[model samples]
Structure formats: structure tokens, C-alpha cells
Target: MTAGRPAPAGPVWDRPEPPSRAALSPLSRERIVAAAIALADADGLGAVSLRKVGAALDAGPMRLYGYLSTKDELLDLMADAVHGEIELPLDAGWRETLRALATGIRAAALRHPWFTELAGGRPNIGPHALGVMEAALAALDRSGRFADIDEMMSARGTVTAYVIGAVRSEIAEQQVERASGVSEAEWRTATGPYLKRMLATGRYPTLARFVREGADRSAEEWFTAGLETVLDGLGQ
Candidate 1:
């Protein structure tokens, strides 16, 4: 309390060292992309950003610049990372392999709804994506049904396009159900009257038949049926 004369120091235990900041988690491109995917999964694709990813990873956004140059690159990384989840059939024939592969992609899209908006949305030359492409090429060529590059590419393009379109529809329905706060069955029941009204107009005879027949299938069933038809056409 008095002037500086060298006061007695407190006990070592009483004057303990101050706690310092905890160490930050290790940073890498995989960690960054994984954090972004987690954010996107919890919230949505719109929620993913460099700042949020950094926060999720306990690192500053600037640290990610070394691995991901820009937000676009981050998105590509996230997309390709998801592509790594697909289950490819190694020894199956072209039709079976392509069918399984496409179904797997759709399943992955369902698992990560954001994937529907990503895969093939850009020039995905990433390794996992390229690997999938390579597998598809090998499967299609293994049939020996396709003579050359053009045929092979066309077959691959057709299946790829089909998978993308089918998954887009699946994602759209899911988004609608999520936004409406209702399951698909509930939403359909809620709108049954309007759909019936629209069908009753007689202008949509085919639509009326579909509604009246109530011929329906699960999303997976529908996708499989459409894929079988496409494969049939291609084989023929």
C-alpha cells in the first residue's frame, strides 16, 4: 500500500500463472471443406461462407486462403468431397454398373441436399469427380456395345443428365416439403382438392387419369423406373 520498496511476493500457488488461449485446431483444405459441408448440412448452402467456415474450424478466414483461393474454389472442393461418397460397382456390367452408380449419386444427393445444386454445376475436374467419370466410361466401354468415343460420351452424358434431372426433382420436392412444414404425404393431401379441381377441368385428361388412377411410386421407385426405360432405349 505504501511507496515502492519491494513488497513481499505472494505464495507461488496463490499467484498462479494466467491461463493462455487454447491452441487452434489444425487447418487443412479437407478440414475447411468439411466445416463448410457441416454448415451447409445444418443450415443450407447459403449459410456456407469463408467466415463461417473459419469460425466453425476455430481459425481465421485468412488461413483458408492458402488452401482455397476463393469462395468458388471452396464450393468446388465441397462438391467434389461429396462426390467421394458414391458407391461404385466395380465388376458389374455397363447397365448394372451405370444403374447402381446413378442411384448412388441420387442417394448421395438425398443425403446432402446441397449436392443436387453442385455436382456438374461447374467444370468438375476434381479427382473424385474424375474418378466417377472414369468408372462410368469403363463400365460403358466394357459392354463393347459402344463403338467409339462419341457413343461412349453420349451414353455417359445421357445417364449423367438423367441422374441430375431426377435428383433435381427430388431436391425440389424436399425443399418444398421443408418450406411448407409438412411431409410429402401431408402436403399432397392438403393440396388434393386443388389437384382434383385442376384435373376435373377435362382439359388435362391425362392428368385426370393419373390422379384418378392414383398410380404412384416412391421417389426411389420412380427414379429406378425412369432409369430402366432410359437404359432400355440405349440398349436397343
Candidate 2:
């Protein structure tokens, strides 16, 4: 060997190699979304971010970019993943199937409160979300009960809209209770004076009567009653 110029850095292989990244958690779109969903479920949707999700996997935020281009895409993926969870029966009739679908969707929303919060932020045309829609549509269309196509489609929309609206309200209350550590009924009781003052104004006679006579409705009772009302409207 000529032994010149510090031996030419000893054939380059003598340089120390990077400590193998083998210990790093492998990441994928599904894994990233799952991490985000887990964070959201444990905390709330506001808590999910690329940095937080990556940290959950013990990786860096840049690793998530390959899988999710933007935060909205991750949210969409999380919503659709929940959509895939709604269990459907193999051969239930239209009314029964739609009812079950609505019920399952509500259960899923309650299971993941952030789901109801983000679902309406974007149109969920992802595969699983579309699969849910197609399943409900196929079931409804097969019944041939409506006078026209518009009616049938509207029926699907009615059920979907009702469930989204109802579950969103239910979950918002649950989250508020969690955050404030005060039950909703307790909050209402705390605000009873304002309600009575408003009632004294005599602006809402119907509301006043309901307040005086109506039994306290549980979340399920409210949701089920609203769902049945929507279903009854669709049956016409």
C-alpha cells in the first residue's frame, strides 16, 4: 500500500455505520391512522397531529408524510375505518337493516366521540365509507316500496342525516361532561334559574309545557325515538 493521504480513509468501509434503524416501529397508512384514532379516542380530535401520532409510534413526524399527505386525509381515513366497523346482517329486510345500520353507526359514534365530530368535516367517499353507503342503498332499493328513485334515495339520506345529527348531539354532551366533570343534568340544574326566568317571559309555551310535564329522556330514548320518527317518514 502506498500509505499516502492518511491511507485514503481506509477503503471507506472502516467508517462507522449508522446504528441500524431496526428498532424503529414500522409505519403504514393504516398504522398511522390507527395511532391518530387512538389518540383522539383517549383525548379528543384536537389532540391528534402528525407529531403526536408519530410520537405514539416512536418515530418522527416526517415518517407520516409518506402515508398521509395532510391532516384532513388522516381524519378521513379514521372516519372510514370506523365506518368499516358497523356490522351488517346478511339478509335483513330494508327497514330492519337500515335500523340496524343506524343503530350500529350510533354505537360506533358513541364508542369514538371524535368520529361524530370529524365525519361531517368532509365527504367520506373512501372505500369503506362507500361500502357502507352502497350496502344501505342496495338494501333500500331492493325493497321497491318507494314511489320513485328520489324517494328511495331520500330515505337513505333521512336515516343517515338523522343518525349523524342525533349522535353528534349525544356525543357532544358526553364530551362536555367529561371535560367539565359535571353531569349534564347537573349543568341544567345549575342553570335552572335562567330557564325559569326565560319561561316567565312566556316566549316558549310549548317548551315550558314540556319542561313542566316531560319525563327526562335518556340519550338512547331520544335517539331511538328520533330514528323511529325518521323511519316512519320514510315508510310513507
Candidate 3:
């Protein structure tokens, strides 16, 4: 089995047959997940009530209960569904591998901003999530230089947490833009004078410099710099 393969839920040979596209009468997990993803994409994660999902699929809410036990279960499935969208390379160097993993995760989170909110609500150890975890661990193992297993594990957590925190901040910024109709750059432009005036009070020259410099850094530069700093820290 591959390092990231999800645990055998059941015999592969015993897997249930998928419903035909023409078989409108058959309700399956894939259809249910698609409906949930659409509802989430359209209205955000909080809008994904079982009833709403069922309504989107033209089924009664009670009918969904037979397939998904509760809203939590549905969310778990939804989180995994979002994870399944991430693609990993079969071969890469250690830094390239880790960078790819981080980039893929960031892309996935951006594509499904709802998934970040779901992460807080659900205890997601689903297949795709496991695959991500396994892939990161495998990459570190293949690096062949870590002194302690515990240290390696801790470094991995730190790397992932930093990435997730950055992604969450970006998502929040985007959500604010959507709701308030203010571009981030516009917000910065509006606030910059007030912030600079406050900082010029001189108690925090370092912070003032950062704010000024940060204004000049493009979003990509900020993200790349942060990721590189984290990688450098891990090296030490």
C-alpha cells in the first residue's frame, strides 16, 4: 500500500457499484458530496444545513439522514471532499516536495474557503486529510537528516500550523472584501496615513519600518518570505 493510502474501510473487491448517470432514482455519496460542495461554494460553509443540501438535490431532508447521520458527519465528508481536490507529485526532491505540499494545501484552502471554517467545526481524519499528513511525514522521512523522530514531528506541525494560519488570514481578508466591497489595497491606502502617524510617535521605530516596508511588498513576496523564514527556522 502507498504511504498515504487511506485505511481499508472494507474489502476493495466488495466495493459497492456506482449508480448510473441515467439512474435518477439512486442517491449516492458522490452526489450528496457534490450538492454539499455547491451549497458551500455558493453560500459559504454555514449555509450547508442538511435540509439545504437535500433541497439542492431535490430530496427531503429526512432522506439525507439515512445516508449521513448528522450535520457533523456531513461536514466531515465535506472536509474530505475538499481535500480530495489536492494533487501531489509522485517524485520530487525534499525541499521541492515540501514546497509542493504547502503550495497545494494553500491552493486547496483558497479554492474551498469554506473548508477552513469546517476545520474548526469538524474532527477531520478522513482519507484525503490522512493522505496529506502521510505525504508530509514521508517527505520528512526521506530527507534523511533529522536527529529525532519527535523533533521531526514537531517541525512538521509547526510548518503546517504556520501555513494554515497564513491561509486562514488570507481567507478572512477575502471574506471581508466580499462582504464590505473594499479591496485590501484600498483598505491599506485608507488606513496607511493614520497608521503611519500613530507609528511616527516613535515608541516603535521597528514596527513603523515594517509597516512602511510591508506596504511596498507584494502579497506574493510577503507569502514567499514568510514561507522561506519558516523553512530556515526549521533548518536550525
Candidate 4:
């Protein structure tokens, strides 16, 4: 008999029809996680309920229970999966290492804005998260300035904090865009009367000059400049 192909009396397709969940291979934890992440990416984390996730994966919500005891565990898995996308550093030197690490994490958060919400929930003590931290800390350790573990940990904290702040700023920009329905430039224009009113009061001469001289500057430019200043301070 020909392998896979149906008999002469049957359909020509060799493959069996994909089965319903009742007859299908059981849904695994990995399948649940991938579905949840897809849901998050498509419709934000708020849309990633158990039922919705299961629907996306073609499995019953009850099937997810076998893998995840609660939605929280699923969230944890989702967060770790996002972190996994942040490829670990393969090169040396603390500055290069820190820059690459921070940039990669920032990109990941940008890719999945929901990850930012997960960052504050728990100490990411999972293997994947731990390994990322360890890689970064190890690079910093090679610098030898951090004689004490606390100091090294603090330094690591600063870098991660910086990335968190950057991601939050990104989230805020999206929120502002939705709420204001105006570009930053348009916002400045719209708020000119208020800015002028404050400046005319004579209490904000410095701010007045700044507003006058840099009225055309974009909020994004200001944010980037501020972030660079922060990184410079951390490097120093």
C-alpha cells in the first residue's frame, strides 16, 4: 500500500484530517504560552484571558489548566518567553555589554508592550530571566569596580531600571497619542496660550526662554536627549 495516501475508494489527500480537540493531540504548556503571546501582541495583554487564549490555540480553556495552575503562571510563562526573544550577549566589555543588553530588552518591550506590565509583578527569578541578569552582571563583574555584591547588584538594578523607564515612556507616548489625538507638535501649539500665560507671570523666566527658544523641538527628541544623559551618568 502507498504510505499516507488514501485508498482508491477514499479521498486523495494522504494526511488525516486535523482532529477536533477531543481527538487531537493534547494541548501542551508551550502551545498555551504561544497562544497567549499571540493574543497579547494582537490585542494587548488585557485580551489574553484563558478562554480567548484557548480559542486562539484551538484548545478548550480547560486544557490550559493541565499546564498552568492559574492565569498568573501563564503570565509568568508569557513574560519569560518574551525575555527569551532578547538574545543573550555573546561579546565582552561592560559598556558594550550593558548597551547591548539594555537595547535588546528595550526592543523586546517595544515589540510586546504587555511585557512592561509583567516586569513589576515579581522578581523574575525564573531560569531564563536569571540567566539574562547573570549574563549582564557577569559582564559588569569583569569590570572589577564592583567589589561588593551589593554594589554590583545596584549597578545592574540601575541598568534594568533605565530600560523599564524607557519602556514606560514608550507606553506613555502611545497613551498620549490616543488620549490627545494630536502629535506632540500639535499639543505644543494647542497649549501655547497656557505656556504663555505661565511665562508672562514672570515666575518662569528660565522656562519661558526654553519655551521660546525650543518651541519647535519634539517631545521625542527631548526624551531621547534625557535618556542619553541618564546613560552617560550611569556610565560615569
Candidate 5:
């Protein structure tokens, strides 16, 4: 060292190095969103909160703020993560593509029932969500069925509306069954006598006829039938 220069600051050799601290699991947006999703899956959307998600991660609620600004933002992330579950077929026709997309979305919604609540109300701009939109639009554009982009978008919107509405209804029924601890079949059987009594009054002839004549179809059958009807209309 130069005589005029102060010796460079050096570590204290006599002192033991600071006790090694155990590494905490690293926090990330992915981990935070995943934790939030798990809470939503186990319970309903209402069960998920920053505090609870933080607790799941062994972090404080404030620690989540670094990755998420608000609960709505967290919800957006969760919705997109579920959207990632949808599989897009690359070589199918437009109608088939749309069908597959709708089916995939319905499956995802059933898996994460809260997803139906978040869907269709706001724009989902996350990459996975945007990929879904892109796949639909690209299929329509490639089909050459639309007069213009406006018509194409209208078709897409219509399908989206139908899927969201149908899935919401399905989820609502599932929730009702869960809450009542009664299956739909059991509920119908239990209420059949009362329904017959009410229909016997002759005020609901159409409903009575439908009740007697309507085919017993699974929820999947109903959903697929509705989806096909929508697609048929679009194909025209």
C-alpha cells in the first residue's frame, strides 16, 4: 500500500463470520399465484385472501404486496392460470376448434368453479388467456366464414357468452347440491310428488308436458347440445 493511502477496509479476521442464516424459500409471483389458486380450489373464491395465501406460503400478508397490488389483480392472475389448462388443437376446422375450446374452458371452469365468476366480466389480458382468444379468432379468420372482423368478433363473443352462462349455471347447481348434501337426482325424486301436485292444477300444461316428455340428459349432454346449436347458427 502507498504510504499516503489509507489501508483498504478489510474483513475482521479475528471475528467469526456472521452465523449462516437458513435460506428461506424464495418468493415469486408464480408461487404467490399458485398459493392463491390452491386456496381457491380447496374452498371457494371467498376463502382466498392475501393473508391466507401468505399463510399458505409461510409469508406475511404484506409480503404478497410485493407481487400483487390488490385482490382483483390476484384474481386476474388466478383466472389466467386456470386458462392455461385449456388445450388448443392446431389442425382442427373452425367449428371443431371452437368446440374443443369451449369444452376445454368448461372443464377448466368445473375444476376451478370460481373461474366462472371471474370470467367474461373483464378483459383477461394475461398471456394464457390471450392465447385462448387468439386461438378462437385465428380459427374464425382462417375459416373465411366471416364477412369482416366485426362479424368474426361477434361470433366469438356469442360463443363466449354461451359458455360462461352455461358454466355458471352448472357451477351453481353443483354448489347447491354441495350445500344441500343432495344430488340432483335425489332432489328431483324428493320433490317429484309436490311438482306433480302443482302440475295437476292444469296451470302449467306446457311445463307439465315437458316434464313428462323431456329426455333425461346429463349436464354434459345439455352443454354439448347448447354448444352445437350455437355453432350451427354461427356456421350459417
Candidate 6:
């Protein structure tokens, strides 16, 4: 009965359209995570911040809040995304399955060094990370070597501990090289005289022998040898 209100304009849906605005690509968690990954890859984990990530994606930091609540969440996404790069083998023997997982993780860590920095401290419960863990546990269970689930989990933890420690060592060596602008060989050569002097004191016979006779293995070879030793221990 309030006829003076002009029928309430027949609903807002009947209103005329406003001028069109420029169309921008919609934001997504994937995009945000990807942007953060790229930043970490380029400049290391310290370089990654929500504002920088948002700038990388051409969005404001506040806009990213809709997709993730905190930078830690974004990092968890990035870590899982890196995990997604690992290839899960099919129908392989237990040893082969574990080898594939370990090597795939190593490869991924080499590509994204920041990943090793976040590897153990934070809980990686994302889907891809969980998939990798699931694959390893299943392989361990199928091997029938473990006495029980407890032993199986222990084996998994041992292998993971080795991998994370080994990869962190590798990445640290790499960072040292990158920072010093000196290759490992170059550094060894530069320090050769000092090392020789120290070794001459006879305080490090084993190490001196190692320095003289150690096999000149690449990083990959070292990683594989260590991994194989761990696998053998698990087998026994």
C-alpha cells in the first residue's frame, strides 16, 4: 500500500548496467602458490613474502588473504607443489620404489633449494606430500621385511631423515659455492697447502688418507651410495 515508493524499482535486477571495466584474470590458490614458489626459487626463502608474492602475481597482499591465511600456509602449498614434481613408480620392487622416491626428492630439492630448508621443520600434510609418504609406506609394507607397522614406519623415517640431511648438506655446499663464486674443486685447491700442513701433523690419518685416496665421486654418486647403505640396513 506504500504506492509513493514507486513500486520499489521492481528489484535491483531491473536496473541499468554500469560501464564495463577491464577484465583481469581471476586469482587462485594455485596462482598464488606458484608465484611464491618462483620467488623462493629465484632469491631463496628469505625473499618470499606475501607482499612480494602478490606483486609477482599482479595482486595486492590483501587479495592473497582470500586464498591463504598466512605466509606459512603459502609455504606449505609451495612445498607440496614441489613434492608434486616427484614421479611415483608403479609395480616396481620395494627397493626400486624407495629409490625412485628418494631420487625424485633429491632432484626436486636441487631444482628448488628452498624446499630442503622447509623439509623437516614444518608438517608437510598437503595432498602431494601425503601421496609421496603414502607411496613410501605402501612400498615398505609390501616388502614384508618389517616385523610390523612400527618397524615399517621406522624404516620410512630413517630413509627420510637420511634424505633430508643429505640434501641439506648438498644444498649448503651449493650455497657456499654460489656465495663465494668458487667451485668445490677451486676451494679445495686454494686450501690445499693449509690442508697439507694440517695433515702433516698426523692428527687425522684417516681423513688425510681420505683426502689422498677418496674416490672422486659426483654429488649424485655420493647421494646414491648413502641411500643404498640406508636401504641395505633396512633390508637386514
Best by TM-score: 6
What range of 10 consecutive residues in model 2 has the weakest lDDT sum? 5-14
Any idea what lDDT model 6 has? 0.84
lDDT of each: 0.81, 0.80, 0.74, 0.74, 0.85, 0.84
TM-score of 3: 0.83
Q: Which candidate tops lDDT?
A: 5
**Of the pair 2 and 6, which is ahead by TM-score?**
6
* Clash-forming residue pairs, model 4: none
Per-residue alpha-carbon lDDT of candidate 1 for residues 167-196, written as tens digits (9 for 90 to 100):
899889878878878997787788999987
Q: Write the per-residue lDDT of candidate 5 for residues 1-236, one digit (tens) a residue.
A: 23464443431122233333453756777788899888988898899988899889898977666555567778988988999999977967889989999999999999988998888778787778889998999999999989999998899889999999999999899889999999988998999999999999999999999998998999999999999999999998
Candidate 1 off by > 4 Å: 1-23
**In candidate 6, how many Å is residue 56 off?**
1.3
Candidate 2 lDDT over 1-236, as tens digits, reads 22241332321222433333455598766688888889998988899988899999999987665555567767877888999899875567788889999999999998898887766666677777788778788787788887777877788888988899989888878767988999877998999999999998999999999999998888899898888888888787
Model 5 earns a TM-score of 0.86
Model 1, position 34, has a per-residue lDDT of 87
Whole-model lDDT for model 3 versus the true structure? Answer: 0.74
Instruction: Return whichever of 1 and 2 wins on lDDT.
Output: 1
The C-alpha RMSD in Å for every predicted model, in order, reads 13.5, 11.2, 6.3, 11.1, 11.7, 10.4
| Local accuracy of candidate 4 as per-residue lDDT tens digits, 1-236 | 32563333322122232233554645766677898998898888889889998888777877665555557767877888888888788658776777777777877887888888897567776567877888888987888867777877888888788778877887778777877789877887898889788789999888888876875645455545655666577567
Off by more than 4 A, model 2:
1-23, 197-203
Error of 4 at 209 (Å): 3.9
The parts of candidate 3 lying over 4 Å away from their true place are 1-25, 120-123
Return the TM-score for each candidate structure: 0.85, 0.81, 0.83, 0.80, 0.86, 0.88
Model 3, 1-236: lDDT tens digits are 32563454442223443434553445777788889988888888778888888888888876665465567667777888887777865556556666777778788888888777765453468888778767777777778767777877777777777777888888888888989999988998999889878998998999977876756775556776788898888776
Cα misplacement distance, residue 226 of candidate 3 (Å): 1.1
